[model samples]
Every structure is written in structure tokens, then in C-alpha cells.
Target: MSAEIPAWLALESGLVMQGRAVGAEGEKGGDLVFNTAMSGYHEILTDPSYAGQVVLMTYPQIGNYGVVDEDAESARAWPEAFVMREMSSIHSNHRATSSLPAWLKEQGIVAIDGIDTRELTKHVRERGSLRCVVSTTDGDTTSLVAKAKATPSTDGRDLASVVTTGAPYTWAEGYHESYPHELGRAFDGAGTKGGGERIRVVAYDFGIKRNILRSLVHCGFDVTVVPAGTPADDALAHDPQAIFLSNGPGDPAAVSSGIAAVSDLIGKRPIFGICLGHQILSIVLGAKTSKMPFGHHGANHPVRDLQTGKIEITSQNHSFAVETDSLPDHLELTHLNLNDHTVEGMRHKTEKVMSVQYHPEAAPGPLDAGHLFSRFREFVAG
Candidate 1:
């Protein structure tokens, strides 16, 4: 066994928590946020919405199932570092190819364990998200705090460009793991079939999750994912039956290119957007957006379908939300978050465009929201 190295995390507000470095020995700093989910640490770490932030998992014990390539939301981890109360020393999972610590080291991510995450989380909840530094190399609290305080704000930055694909590509795979085939949908790897023709679909990738592509493919659509900045005419050139706008990081209004392109695509095709895509769509349609206090970042969020009066527990991760009152007369609210009564889903009355502020992909969340994908397919088929 190796000797445990001492470490510490210093918040920009001058609070310090001592711990031991669990992963790579390094230093990193960024906006601090917390996730309340008990599992799927891999997905959370790789999510592009976590870009330029240090994620502190509120769950007590983490890294028990180990790390697997099959569970990755993206190609690499995006968090500046990971914080936790305890990290499992032994990893035991059938599909895991590497231990979490080893994987973090390989990915050049710094992790710290042995801190009281509950207290830290409570502090963040009260004060809202703030700049923070977690380090294994530096122990000077004053210097670390100074560095954290000096870090730039993450809002309004074009972080989508940092994580989006450089060129257009087709996603052919479907959900192979994470749960059983209970959604009444099946994918044969190459494509999926749901009693409909293989409708060509254009997907705008503003840091999309793999399961979203899988969901579209499994719903019987041929998906072509273009960059976040792709123009409306270029996307329409494929003559897609529908268009999908993906979720991503940072302020939605700052993505000027996406707002402009989506604006042009409006009323041209059947459109569906999720998370950041939802915010962009709303902005283009004369709605307003504002940053939330602590932001929604969990899987157990309850959302209500206003049309059916049914409540669906969902998985969500976003810092900004669309103002319900700012919506245009043509836009109709479809879903609302039961926890905060925020806008969760919307659609233009006269056009085939709709969007949701929560992830229906359910990679690390719930399956109740999966019906939205099927509905999207039905819209395209009609």
C-alpha cells in the first residue's frame, strides 16, 4: 500500500476543508457545484455542462462500482476535479476495465476524499455556487483562496465550442447498458426501428450525451449530428424529417450562433431541444432566461405534464431556466418542474417545434422522461 498524501480544498470565500488526495496529484480550480445522485459518477464527471467546474458529489461513498467505458457520457471527464467524503478502496464491477482512481489519473483529473461533503454542500447551497480550488500540490490556504477568487466567472462563456464536435457525423449506436429493455424500444446496433420508416434527422451537438443519440436512433431516426454553430440552411440541406437541439454548458444567451441558427430553423422543421437547447429555443422565441440560485443538478426532480396532468420524475442538470411569462402568445407551456414550478417543456402552437428543459435521455436518471423521444418520432412521422 502507498502512503496517503494530505490535501485540501479552499473556497474563494475563505473556507478550507482538509482531506487526502485520491486520484492524480495536481491542482485545479473553478466554479463549485454539487450533485446529489448516489451513483453514475462517471456520467456526471464527463458531462459537458460540468465544464470549468469542480464537482463535489454529495453522496457519501463513491467509486465503488469502478469506472467503465460503456458508461461515459462523453469522450473525457470535463470537471476540473472531483470532491467526495469517501472513495472506495476496492473496485468490483463486472464491466469495469479500470479503477476510478487509475482512470482519474489517466485522465489528468484531481480528486480528494475524506472531506465532510454534507457540510460543504450545505455551505454551497446557502451561498450558491462559487469559485473554488482543490489541490494536492499546494497547502497554503491563502494562496489557494487567492487563486480561486481570481478565477473568471463561468457564465456567458462559449464553452460549447470547447466540447462540441469539429465536423458532422452520424451516430449509429443505441443504449446497450444502464438498464433493461423496458422502454418497448429496441436497437440492433446499426439502427433502431419503432414501426416507422428510418426518417433522416439533423441533430445540433452542443455537447450532447451519447444516450440522446441512442434514443433518437432507437426511436427509428437516422441522426446526423452537426456542430453547435451549423447554419439553418446547411442543417436543412439534409432534408431531415425533424431537427434535434442538444444540451450543453454555460449561459444559453452567450451562444449567439446557436440562437441565430435555431431562429432561422424555426417554423422550417419539426424541432426538439433539451436543457441548454431549451433555453436557446426559448430565447429565440421571445422568452427570457435567468440563472437559478443553486441550479437544478440531480436525477430525482419531479416534472408535471400540464396537458396530461401526470407527474414524471426526471434527471436534470442545468443552471439557467426560461421565464414562463416571457413566452410568446404562440408558444404553449407543456411541462413544469413540480419542485420549483419552472418551465420544463414548451411548444409553438402553430409550428412543429417543441423543447424541454430536462434531459429525456435519462443516462443517469429516470426512464419516465423517455416517452418524449417516442413523441418526437411520432411528430416527424406525421
Candidate 2:
């Protein structure tokens, strides 16, 4: 085997772990968090919400399938650094166009493997997600620790701006890649039964994932994704049948302006939100949010849908959650996490507004909850 390249990850709390660099050779800094998903490393790497963050995967043996263009959650990789337990030396999947290490190198992302991720994850869970620095070139552990300490936390950061697209864009058409035979046989109930009038949906891009957009498109919506800071009036100008708020990073309270915009658009249009978007929506609805001790960052979290009384295994990645008691009477809880009993979803009683704390797109997780997108389409179609 080649000589292991030296690298280290230092946290603001003065904790430092040494390992070998596997991707690009350089330095990276961000808030460090751990994800427990056993697969979909590509989607996790490309997820825009991971921007300005260093992700440590708890699952050992990563990169078994390699990377594929079709699995990317965004146009570019966003995670500042990646930490894994082990890196597969050889590519092993037919769908893989390139290996994970090669892809990370191409994207200029720093990564390290063969680390004790379980212990690291436990530390993060105990102390909370902290600012961290990853360095391949700098072996000075003391200075690296200082740098990590000097790094500002995600508290007031407008991370959404850093990840959102500069311009609006559209995605593939139709609710499915191909029409299902069951839908074909079912009678069309709404306008234009034959083809059905496509719902016009506008999504406020606060670090949106490609899978979310794809899910929207799959639900028979013509999706128009705008920038994170796009004004409510500008969104209204689109005359969209419904509005969507996407998942993102950092504190929801920090994005006060976006919350105001969501508040203004509440009764004016049908709305749906997820992750950070869900927190913002809660704030708009006069609800409060609090940071979790460890935060949910995995694909196997279970949430119970209060409306349907069904349990769904979900993909979650956020550090904050909406306070269930703080929700106004106008809004009602729609789902709750089975593990911690936190509010996982909510919906406005009068307005066509709904949100979920977990990802329904399921890029690196289960697709059982994808029906939420169809519900949004139905709300817009009305």
C-alpha cells in the first residue's frame, strides 16, 4: 500500500483526531457533524445543505459502490470535508463512473478515512456540533486546534445564501419518469382529466436538493426554484399555484428575513417545507425552535404520521427542531419522531401550508414518504 498521507481534524472544543488524507490535499473548516447512513455517500457529499460543514460518517466501509452522476443531490459537491471509517481502494459497481476518492479530488473536497468515527460521533453527540478544521498540509496539531477554535459557529451564518443557486432553474417534467399503469387506469378527477393541468410550483431555494426538485416534478408540477433570499413579492409575481421552502443549514432564527417572507406568503398561497425550511415555517407560524443536543443526521429515523397513523423510516439531517408546544392553534402537528418524540411534521389548519422535519426526497434513504410530494401537487391543483 502507498504511504498514508497525514491529516488531522480539530474541533473547537480542543479535540483533535489524526488520520490519513484520501481526497484533495489542502485544508478545510466548518461545523463538524456525524451522519450514520450506511450508503449513498455520493448523495450525502453533493447535498447542498452540507455546505460549510465537515461530515463524519459513522458507518464503516464506505465507497463500495463508487460515485455516479445520477446520484448527485446537486450540481456540485458542497461538504467542506468528509470523514469516513474506511475507504474502499477499488471501485465495484457497474453504475459507478468514478470512485469516491477520485470524485472528491476532482471537486477539490478534502476527505480522510480510517478514523474511529464511532468515538468521534459520540463526542459530537455529547458536546453538540462544533466548529472544526481539517488539514492535510498542516501537521501542526496545536495551530490546527487554534484554527478550529477561532472558527465561528453556524449561529448567525447565512448558510442558505452560500448554497442557493444564483438563478432560477427547472427540472424534468411529470410526476414519474414514466406513467404508472395504475394511474393510467384510474379516472382523472381534476382539470383536463386526459393529461391534467400541471401544477405551477415555485420553490424558494435555501440549499435545495436535486431529489426534492425531482420529487416535485414527479408529482406533476412545473417547478421553478429561486434563490434563498428571493422576496415574497418576487415569488408571488410568478403566480405559482403553490410555494415550496427547501431544507438548508444553520439556525432558523438567524434567517429572520426569510421567516418574514414565509409569514407573508402563509395565507396567500399553498406552501410546503422540509428540514430548515420546516423550522422557518414554524417561526412564521409563531412557533419556536430549539437546537437538539446531538441533532438528527441519519437515514433510518422513524416518524409517525399523525394524519395517516403510519410510521415511516425517514432521512433526517438538521441540528434544530420546532417546539411542538409553540405551534399556534392555526397549525397542527402532522408527524412525530418515534425516537425522541420531537415534532417531525406540521400543517396549518386553515391555510394550505404543510412541512416535515425529515427529508421525503430520500436520496440516501427510504422513498416510502415520497407521497408527500404528491400531496403538495394535489394542494396546488386545487
Q: Top TM-score: which candidate number?
A: 1
TM agreement with the true structure for every prediction: 0.96, 0.93
Alpha-carbon shift of residue 30 in model 2 (angstroms): 1.5
lDDT at 203 for candidate 2? 92
Candidate 2 lDDT over residue span 145-207, tens digit each: 999988766777778888888987776643343323333222233323345667888899898
lDDT agreement with native, every candidate: 0.87, 0.84
Flag regions of model 2 displaced more than 4 Å.
173-194
- Where is model 1 poorest over a 10-residue stretch in terms of lDDT? 185-194
Model 1 deviation from the true structure expressed as Cα RMSD, one decimal place: 2.1
Please give the range of 10 consecutive residues that has the lowest summed lDDT in model 2.
183-192
